[model samples]
Target: MVYALTTRITLSTYESFFRIVRQILPLNYNQLTIITDYERGLMNAVRIVFPQTKLQGCWFHFCQSVIRYCKRSMNSLFQLFQTSVEAATVLRMVLALPHLPAESQINCNFTMLDGFQIIVDYVNQQPVIRERLQAFLFGYIQDFWFRQITAENISVFGLEFLKNDINRLLLYKL
Candidate 1:
């Protein structure tokens, strides 16, 4: 049931969202999975209104946002490699997060310390990137990845397959 159509064209405010949600019938929180982009306002409202609902953000949007931010400052960091390979590698590492499971402790501990090193090494030598990376990438994404790739979470990331593919691709390139 449509509780309330948009009465006017405007950006959503917490009050507006709250009003719409309260009008809707009681929801089954057990089956409610809300997938959204990184909108804290809306997310906060949902948490307050429906505390038990599972609300996860869109992985693609999160990664794309990170990727765009990195691209703007990448030139300062990736002077060691040709642009083509460098861009591909940078994006591969960023995009790989979504494909990985939320936790990897139950499965093999294919942790992401290597990936962390790659990221740190790429940015460490460049002053501008190092500064911006600490600000943009460290707080949220770093903590999130560490939690997911820790020694206790179940792993859905395909380690063997990725290794084989990487080997084949490198062989072809070399």
Candidate 2:
């Protein structure tokens, strides 16, 4: 656990803070997994300071961001998510992507790709909606979730223990 009161939030400030953390903690960078929000500066700082450490984004934050985006930019989709059970289910499934198995299991080889494929398959079922809302939502998912934040950073995949702990923390906070 670490805490610092900072007046400025920037890449250099985060780098300095992380450097201090590195100096104080006897961290095994390879084994360390830091869960954070999708703050670009902080994430970049961590990468620069501890290149080998695994950086995971908070799942709650990811969900919150998606919902917020829908509310602000895609109000029609947001309304559908609230009123339509099928749309709600789809939204839930998208949010649950991070909770799905990151790697191949012994009995079932269900991976993130499989989860995404399921969504794509479902979306493709409706040709009319697929052209408009599906395109927008999938594009947002692909660009922001996949290309920008990345599946590796947002998904719980290989960090079950961390996921459980994070859930507990989230529950406690809520």
Candidate 3:
């Protein structure tokens, strides 16, 4: 629940947000939840401070990252899914899987599901991309949307979706 001071949103400005959140909410709070726009600086700072927090960037922000890293055609398909309930439903199911072969992970920009082996393979295969994706998933994916309602119309991504998204991107099947 933070915004930039000016028009341009930089990491420094974003980091200030955690300070603001801390000032308002006590550090003794163990069950803290953070929702942010996935600005790298803010994300990094949050990690340093709240290592175990349930951090979730909005679905919009998650989609942006997917579009940024995925291929043009894959992005287009995702866009279509975004607009259609049926597609998104199929996508939601397909994206909920948490395991894939090593080669498939690379084609989809190094995203993978949550498992010690899957994460390790992904990281070993592509260190830089794996780091970014892992940061995004952290606590965010681990406890995703236990209370989610279909009317909410936003997908809470976790390692499960990461695995599924990669498969779809690689096969162009879903």
Candidate 4:
């Protein structure tokens, strides 16, 4: 069985958690996995103590970097990317693209279903912003691609951007 948890805290908090877990749980080599937010110091500690555990930076946090680089005004394009590839067919399309041009790569990576959730979750808490965002995403998709169900499109916001070219929005039916 696989288990995952996202905890926000200082390095010391994670250090303490590991220390306590080590003492209480009879942990074995390569039995634990740590998906962290890439705090180098904390990762160092984990490495020193649990050498066999696999540690990876959280994908959710990595997406934030993409969002930061992406244009704020082009958010609607991001939504189309998300809705288009949230499922099996679209996901396969996303997985297949590795060497696409830079602009299209951004669209391909940023529009991932998994990514949209994290971005929109943060956006949704603001006053009236969620509705406005919903409107924008819907309008963008309808105007370009065929109309799609909102729920299905939004579910895969956790997948990483394999391709980054978003400018390709001009070339296809989407």
Q: When superposed on Cα atoms, how far off is each prediction in RMSD?
A: 8.8, 3.1, 13.3, 15.0
Q: CA lDDT of 151 in candidate 2?
A: 75
TM-score winner between 2 and 3, please give it: 2
- Identify the candidate with maximal TM-score: 2
What is the per-residue lDDT of model 3 for residues 97-163, given as tens digits with 9 covering 90 to 100? 2232222343453323323234335444654344434432332333342122110223343333345
> How would you encode candidate 4's per-residue C-alpha lDDT over 1-174 as one tens digit per residue?
223253755566666666766787776748666554445566666777677886544333333422332225455534544564332232233322222221224445543343434444555565434554564434543232112322222222334441232323223232
CA lDDT of 138 in candidate 3? 39
Clashes of each: 7, 0, 0, 18
How does residue 25 of candidate 2 score in lDDT? 90
Candidate 3 segments whose C-alpha is farther than 4 A from its true place = 1-5, 67-174
Candidate lDDT values, in order: 0.51, 0.76, 0.45, 0.43
lDDT per residue as tens, model 1, 65-157: 555455455434233223445444555665565445444447634445555556667767666445645644465356654543231221225
Checking candidate 3 for backbone clashes, the offending pairs are none
Task: List, residue by residue over 1-174, the lDDT tens digit for candidate 2.
Answer: 677789998999999999989998977889988878898998999899999988888877877777777777644778767776666767878888887665677865887668988987886785544554564456788777877887778777656666554675467421
**TM per candidate:** 0.54, 0.81, 0.38, 0.34
Error of 2 at 161 (Å): 4.0
lDDT over C-alpha atoms for residue 108 of model 3: 55
